[model samples]
Target: MSGTLGIDFGTSNSAAGISVDGTPQLIPLEGDELTMPTAVFFDFESKKMRVGAEASEALLRGDEGRYMRGLKSLLGTRLIRESRMLLGERLDFIDIIARFLHEVKTRAETATGETFTKALSGRPVRFHSEDDAKDAQALVDLKECYARAGFDDVAFMNEPEAAALANRDVMQSGDLGLIVDIGGGTSDFTLFRQKGAQDIDILGSYGVRIGGTDFDRRLSITRVMPQLGMGSPIRHAFGNDTHLAPNGIFNDLATWAKIPFLYGPDTIRAAKDLHKFAVHETRLARLVKVLEEELGHDLAFAVEAGKIMANTPDVENPVIRVGMLKRKAVLPLPAEMMTKKLSGLANQIGEAAEATLAEAQIAPDAVTHLIFVGGSSLMQVVENALTSRLPSAQVHRGAALTAIIDGLALGTTQAF
Candidate 1:
């Protein structure tokens, strides 16, 4: 409470903590809960904003409002700075993110009876892995967001490195460990050598712009989008020839960050035009209904839920409950099918981990432990991919949702 506050501002969830007498203690963001969903809702009736679980509740209850998630994925893009009208005010993504962070700061202060003026935040090793300029700008943007959130100064630590710190006890003295921290928008890795009970030597860190949301998007595209006329043929107005529907709308519909933007007038008109074509009118009609009724997020949430259920070992006949889109509409998502759809992405994560070890000039077998963190790390397919690559390493699990914040809270003692 006295020094720096630690914040894990993740794409799917967010948490805050601080060092209390040299021990990391998480602040309860919601009632008796340490972590909160990184979601926001603006109520049209009250003209008030809602954050975290309350926001999700408002969305689920079908309250008339705008709901947004995956805001973290927009940090490096121009859209983050573009203004939109919300609740009678012009606000950009930066302002929206800053407001979420400010809520965190306020809750932490209220919970601990201490104001936090400085912060130590967790960030992916690469916000935009393929674009260096965007990656650099992401950090700058995040810093400004922290400042706007009432933090006078803020420092950042790689998310996987933070997880490594939080799980230092998982490795023996002088043993090498690899931390695989997969979140909603990115997958990060950290290679480190355990030095002592409270010390470690970092070898290297790497990341890729792929994670759980990507899995959801893929599942939606292959399983759900087709039902909404993703690949249906569209007839030309004057000619007998027909072409497959454009992929852009379906792609955006599957993507979490792109859903909110698809509700605009131009996009709806495009969907209607696609619906007007002679090929498979029913499927395209569904697409038009989704746009006009603003049901993209509901579909996205259903897909995400289905993915989680499919990943669970005991669940059978898991299905995406899309009854909101239509009467008793459900998309079957068997575990094997989900695994097959996601195997490529899981392999990509494995490749990134191996690349990290290669960059550090270390052999795969040299790593004695594989510490898995982040919510997405719970997927069996991802674990299988990683374990197959490092067959000799022992696998361990860190606190999936809180490891980064725990480490950031511990790092606060030395951050300043």
Candidate 2:
């Protein structure tokens, strides 16, 4: 029998959920995962593209040529076609979208043991669009793509509202709280009052197209590049914004990496590592640009040791790691250094909070507590920022980063 599923189509991470017996249970894929990379891998000659997160941050660091990511940013922007070309030649934007949607759908379908032909997916409240217009057309386009991908009907919900739904149970005091969702590529804020049961009255929501991925990239370019010197072409390899970058380069890179026969004897020996090399530690990318800034000779090829220290649980080692000169040069970013890169996004969160307050006719003190959600919200700096902004209230840390998507799935069977 067909069932309903919830999908969180995050810019960098995605998750799926569903309701069971009036309770929402997050369906795990591959490894009890709630969030997987919005990335795809492909072969120059292949039948279908490989999607879903199959590699780790360390894997991405050693290779970058064929890795595809940040497809969530393709909504209503001028970079639509440029964003989809990563799937292969002559592919439409919906083709790439359908490919990803299909993969996420398939995994959830398998885990739930029921085909999910209908879904409730989360979307940012405002998507940056062409000529200063909202990306309303993107939703229509996505609907068409969803239909083609075998979804009978797909409904949309404001991401924050979905997150608010996930937290409806604990809010017992009739308090108005702020839900801050700091995701991989965007942050969304919503104010809600628990109206008893599953219903939530959303006051006003706020969002910004900036998140953890931005921090990682900023650290890579601003801090990591300075050590390599400015005027490096390697810096040019990454697009200004992950979503705004040219898709041609990304597609071409993906095309080169995926070999037709992955299990064949003639497969690229470094097949898996190829993408990591480019995305995380492109030695050739480094060598190609080193000479421009007079660092070609002085600069040496290095592995991105602790490249993902930001994701690591241990305070002793950064989530991201880089080792240079045969372990002679190891540049590990400290917690403060990483936190500094996240300040701008936190500032944006503050602005969004104030804006929400202004619209709701409420003061800063009126916000009882700030409920922080998403993977990035767990950062100490982000936690402190919320604390400073609503010093009089508590910071609710019980909600998961997967709250929005989980609620979307929960909404599929129950009323939102």
- Tens digits of per-residue lDDT for model 2, 1-416: 23777888877677888877767788786577777877665543443466665633322443332434666666665445443234346665566777788888898888777888788888877654123354676677667767867888888888888888788866665788888887766677888886766567889987776666555555555455444322222223346422222222222221211111122232223322222334344443432233222221122112122324553556685533333322455567777776777678677767776777788887888888688888778766667767787887767875656788767866887533
Listing every candidate in turn, what is its Cα RMSD in Å to the true structure after a full C-alpha superposition? 0.9, 8.7
Off by over 4 Å in 2: 44-48, 55-65, 83-89, 129-134, 197-199, 228-320, 324-328, 414-416
| Poorly placed runs, candidate 1 (over 4 Å) | none
> How much is the lDDT of residue 346 in candidate 2?
71
lDDT (Cα, tens digit) per residue for candidate 1, span 1-416: 46588999999999999988877899999999999999999989889989999999998898999999999999989999989999999999899999999999999889888878999999999999999999999999999899888899999999998898888777779999999998999999999999977689999999999999999999999999999999989999988999999999999999998898899999999999999984999899999999998999999999999999999999979999989768998989999999999999999999999999999999998889999999999999999999999999999998999999999998898887
lDDT score, candidate 2:
0.61
Strongest candidate by TM-score: 1
Model 1 error, position 252 (Å): 1.1
What lDDT is reached at residue 150 by model 2? 81
Superposing every Cα of model 2 onto the true structure, what RMSD results?
A: 8.7
